[model samples]
Target: MTAAAVACTGLAYAFGDTRAVDGLDLTVAEGEVFGLLGPNGAGKTTAIRCITTLLPVPSGMVAVFGQDAAGDRMAVRRLLGYVPQQLSADQNLTGRENVALFARVFDVPRRERAERVAQALGAVDLTDAADRLAGTYSGGMVRRLELAQALVSAPRLLILDEPTIGLDPIARTSVWEHITAVREATGMTVLVTTHYMDEADQYCDRVALMHRGRIRALGTPTELRKGLGTRRGAAPTDPLPSLEDVFRDVAGSGLDDSSGDFRDVRSTRRTAQRVG
Candidate 1:
């Protein structure tokens, strides 16, 4: 049955004095590929850290699989798997060994760990290179190995932050292929943050566009495109505008500005309500 995999309300984080994620709210449903899309330095990573409980929210609620992240972090972690933007594997270890290490740490049953490791590797199509040292593999294969490690625990909620960044086009496609295949085979809930609009549109059941620490839009790809309104009628309408165009039109080429105008508005409302 589908469930709320992650929920965050009024989440805020700051670095020094600059607010990173300001009063952010988000929700991801189970058995769906939910994508978080934003420009660079738009608090996407910060928001992810809060939901994954890597960083404290300081001013909001973060839950995973119905468990309060702050109060039940261990329980929350058990049901969640994270693939960070950076690779985190031992260079010396073989692909199979890296997955094995994670399985051991997560305490996957010994008898099942081997089979699970093999299955995960196979899912990523890395079984052929399973025994090769991770350092020997290409960037694409390294990503696949990391994905295999994430899947070893059979987690209910998978969080991926820029899982295919910096890869060549062919490698990027390979990674996406494996991700779609694995998610389909396992029926897992995935929360992905991606800068690639096409990938997000292709794979995600729904997407949320974040700008300057707030959700600017949330809908299916088709809905977001339609919300862009029709271009000046030149013959038949184009039917759908590209997400890139929608982003530009919505933000007016200032998506990079982090002035926190939205946060200030939210704070003013809160204060007025409190006074009233």
Candidate 2:
């Protein structure tokens, strides 16, 4: 296996008295897709923030491409591309304009910025919309634009947080296909956090399932499926249960509710809040 592109050891975070990410240890191999699978408020975002230098890791270690996140944040940032959970680009700007902005932030050479912007938009199949205002794009198209902006820096490590959220089935599928194509073409290390079991099963080389601020399980989709004994009682005539079944079985039945609730489990000084 290739060396680790990103590594976190005993990483923890908090809000108020709650522990949002409790001693999380993770590793992502070079050029591989590593998926972080979890329900809402499972600290997936918190962990991503720490790794991407959005939040401080007060008591643990996070490294990107052998650069320490705590001590060498600028160096780490230079090697990473981030697609935040929330929309990040200006609504008034054109798709190409957004890419250009990111290219500049990432310090792509002035002479090459235009070419880089074009390449990024092309990768996400947004070349046709490059000159169009971003506010005119659909949710999926906006997502593609966000992805293009992230890639404009040509980062080696790409971090996507709930990338396909709120997208329709067709749009989600298209986004996943584009993600797969991008990874295959660039050999970039990808770390994605998603609530979708199918996405984790289909696209992730390895997955870590998190629950209530801790990692509950880690394995490839097939390995995890087999480990759950889903195939044990299946006959030649019987079809296997989906990965969602394994996820529910291993991660617990508590996640089965559709309450649409959000939890604030951080241990920071801020008061905890919830959304529904």
Candidate 3:
């Protein structure tokens, strides 16, 4: 049997007195698109950080592609690509330059860097704009540029954190299309975090709903929706429950308007109050 692309057993992380990720266990199979769905402050990012080796994980806790993430950080990093929540591309540099930098950072062979950079940009449909400065690109294009940067190293596993945040519906769909296309072309494992339930239903092969630093539910989108049967007195003949409904049932209410970025607590609170 093939080894899982990612595995976490009894993984935990704390920030000061607050436990951000508490005793989490998860497995992402190779060549699958998996999503960690949660509201703000649910520790999805924290868990992702640990998996990507951005934070120290306890011994025997986390592994990437069968290599211990905590013990074999360099090896794991070699096989992994991460597109963080915040913007990463340097505005002053052209898109090609940004990706070329990542190619160097990932230690792509000196002779192959240019070809790798070109392939990465082409994969994300950014070849035409490769010569343009990233600051001039639209939000959607910026996200795609970041995707290209992540792809420059030819990683086996890709990790995305709220990758389409703050984009319009169309732009969000476009970004995901490129991601799905890349995954299909390379057969890479994708682990993404998002509060957008619709995106999870549309793209993920399996999803884990996290809440309060733990997984509240886990299953395919269809299975999760099936677990919620006519909660609001809707007849069986009515439309099936959506992933959003499943989230509300599993994680309770108040998740509808929540952002996935837990770091922006104050801004989220203000937005919630304004909406309320």
Give the Cα lDDT of each candidate: 0.81, 0.82, 0.87
Taking the tens digit of each residue's C-alpha lDDT, what string does model 2 give over 107-152? Answer: 9999999899999999999999899998888888888888899998
Give the per-residue Cα lDDT of candidate 2 at 242. 68
Whole-model lDDT, model 2: 0.82
- Model 3 TM-score, all chains together: 0.91
Encode model 3's per-residue lDDT on 1-276: one tens digit a residue: 778999999888877767778889999999999999987778888899899999899533898888998888999999999998767889899999999999999999999999999999999899999999988988888888999999999999999988887778988999999999999989999999988889999999999999877898999998888677655666778778999988887777645333334455654444233222
State which candidate has the highest lDDT: 3
TM-scores for candidates 1 onward, in order: 0.88, 0.89, 0.91
Candidate 2 Cα errors over 4 Å, as ranges? 230-238, 253-276
Q: After aligning candidate 3 to the native by TM-score, how far in Å is the CA of 184 from where it should be?
A: 0.9
- When sorted by TM-score, best at the front, the candidate numbers are 3, 2, 1
Pairs in clash, predicted candidate 1 = none
Candidate 1 lDDT score at position 266: 56
- Winner on lDDT between 2 and 3 is 3
Q: On a 0 to 100 scale, what is the lDDT of residue 73 in model 3?
A: 94
